[model samples]
Target: MTHPICRACGTQYAEPRDDCPVCLDERQYVAPGGQRWTSLKELQAEGHSGRFEEQGPDVFGIGVTPEFSIGQRALLLRTPAGNVLWDCVPYLDDEMVRRVEELGGIDHIAISHPHFYSVMVEWAHAFDAPVHLHEADREWVGRPDPALQFWSGRTKPLTDELTLINPGVHFPGSTVLHSSAGDGALFTGDVVNVGPDPRWVSIMYSFPNHVPEQPQKVRAAADLLAGYRFERIYGAWWGRVVTSGGEEVLARSVERYLRFERGE
Candidate 1:
């Protein structure tokens, strides 16, 4: 039996349902027509395929070619310890699996928040890797599996150079991965949105709904990340990378966001 996937978010459900709880939430929205579901087989038949592109040294971005739901690219971080897959996408194919296997495969799958929890269990099972998600947002998980592992607290170290930090701006468990490779890079999955401008990043509660995050929450998130040292910021999607001065961009963006919230 083919598992049903949410048309909006592309999260596979444990069983078929009339409505997707994730889309019905205020943070997300159901289509005007209604809730629609599609299976991965259907998506593949429709010509959706996953591909990987090298973004930096040992860092590759994997995403669907035709662009499936939410259209976020997953980052494959190759480290000396092992490979870490950050923020999964909707579609995974044989080619993707083969390519990943060629690149040493994934040891751990970490999601930044509930929104990016797309087909995580499928990916984990495929690679026999551990799936890590924030414990606070466990309710949003559509498909639970034995590979799923819940974590709490502000910071969790996945490896010597890579650490997951919860900034708590978009969601209670919204996270960013700090890597000590190269100069340093932060793999932020919409937690810190690299924007229309490369010099700034924004925090939002809901990007589709145009809901801005609270000023205090944004400040607190930034404060929490201030301890980290990273020169680049990689957002969830393609072309959303802040190439340099990521630390400065975040500081200025937070200040600007707060000022606007205060009507200054």
Candidate 2:
């Protein structure tokens, strides 16, 4: 009967498929059905019975590495221009790299596409840091070793308080990285996803079903995330979003996805 992964993101695709074809098809689903798997050491033994949550002040949410999907957690900020790892989790051992080198080893490791770019060269050589990725998804780097570092076009600072904004909109170099901390955050990994009315956020075109047949490039990726003022907004799992505001919830989710894709 084995088939229960993806309670949010422990990808294990090989056979016996039903959904989660890279995050639920038909433009992402899971309204009340969407979850299935059978192997990968049972989602890494359920992320070794996962546990870890801080919430604020350098936010942290660990849990979901085991079979991944139970709110898939990974967020630890200390931006003063250093220590940032937006999205990355396919499970990394060694006590999660010694609790992230006692909190300071990771200098940088950005990711908002390529399926969360899991493992990411083993979390960038276990914190020697440097795994940017965005050269147009780099063909969905499913382990394109060599410590990876693609980047190209539209902003990229990395220190002096971090920066790396693409705003292309959901893949195709869909990027977003702007965190000076506190009331200034924007690490949108799915181009933007944080709803359930945490203030507002909902704009998609293909969130796993391929819906960008060209609605003006999904409103030009929500007009490149409406310029940015991010008071908080980080999404990739769970209730989606680790924080809030995030420039009025990404400008009311791009005017409610441009009035539901012009069906106005």
Candidate 3:
């Protein structure tokens, strides 16, 4: 049986489904006219191509090979300790593995939420690495593949050098990773998204569909992150990182959330 892929997020599902289960929630949706599905062999036969864009010395944005209408991207943070694949995609193959290996084999895979848990097991096996998922979001795990090593607790160190932060934003277990990117930097998956304004940082209750959030949760998450001094925030997608004054922008974002939550 052939499955359909959600054009909204590029996630494939078995059989013909009404709507993307991942998007059916408040955060995402299918394109107006629906989507197209292609098998691995079929896609490869067409000579489809995808590539990664270098964002910084050790950061990259991985997008669709042909560049879909919606350029959804994920981050690949490389550090001396190891590499962290943040927010994954549904499509992965040997070619992708080879490319990643050329840059440096991945050591850890962490996602912001379950929706991004696409082909995670396949990814883990490719690099012989363990997936670091927050304990609070265990139920949301889409695959629950045996390869996943679920970890409970506020934070977990991948290799004594890398750290994962769960501020509880988009999801109860929605997390961000804070690793030393040379000089001084923090890789915030989506807990603190870089707004359209490069200088401003943003957050929402739901990001897939642009739904805003209540102030309480925003404030709490912000408070949780106040302890860190990050000069830059590496967001989930392309052009979503603030290079300077990131801490101040984070505090301001929290203030905005407080006002919205309290209706002030």
The TM-score values for the models, in the order shown, are: 0.98, 0.33, 0.86
lDDT score for candidate 1 against the true structure? 0.90
Instruction: Kindly report which residue stretches of model 1 are placed more than 4 angstroms away from their true locations once superposed.
Output: none
Better of 2 and 3 by TM-score: 3
Sort the predicted structures by lDDT, highest score first: 1, 3, 2
Candidate 2, 1-264: lDDT as tens digits? 332334454543323556665454344456455464435355455555444566566756554434444344667676565677777766666676777677766787887765666556656777878888889767545345667888798778877666887766666677778766557777675666675666776556565564653567656666665665667776756556646556766666577666777899
Error of 3 at 5 (Å): 4.4
lDDT of each: 0.90, 0.63, 0.70
How many clashing pairs in candidate 3?
4
Question: Can you write out model 3's per-residue Cα lDDT over 1-264, one digit (the tens) per residue?
Answer: 444545556554445656556666666665666654554445556665557789877787776576543455677877777788887776666778888888898887888776677557657777888888888887755445666777776787775556787887777888887765454566765667787786777777777668876567777778877776677787766777787777787888778666766778
**Model 3 lDDT, full chain set:** 0.70
In order of TM-score, best first, we have: 1, 3, 2
> For residues 1-264, could you state the per-residue lDDT of candidate 1 as single tens digits?
678999888889899999998888888889888888998889989999887898777889999979888889999999999999999988888888999999999999999998898789889988999998989889999988889999999999999999999888888888889998878999998989998788989899998899999888888899989998899999988888998999999999999888888889
Worst 10 residues of 3 by lDDT: 35-44
Better of 1 and 2 by lDDT: 1
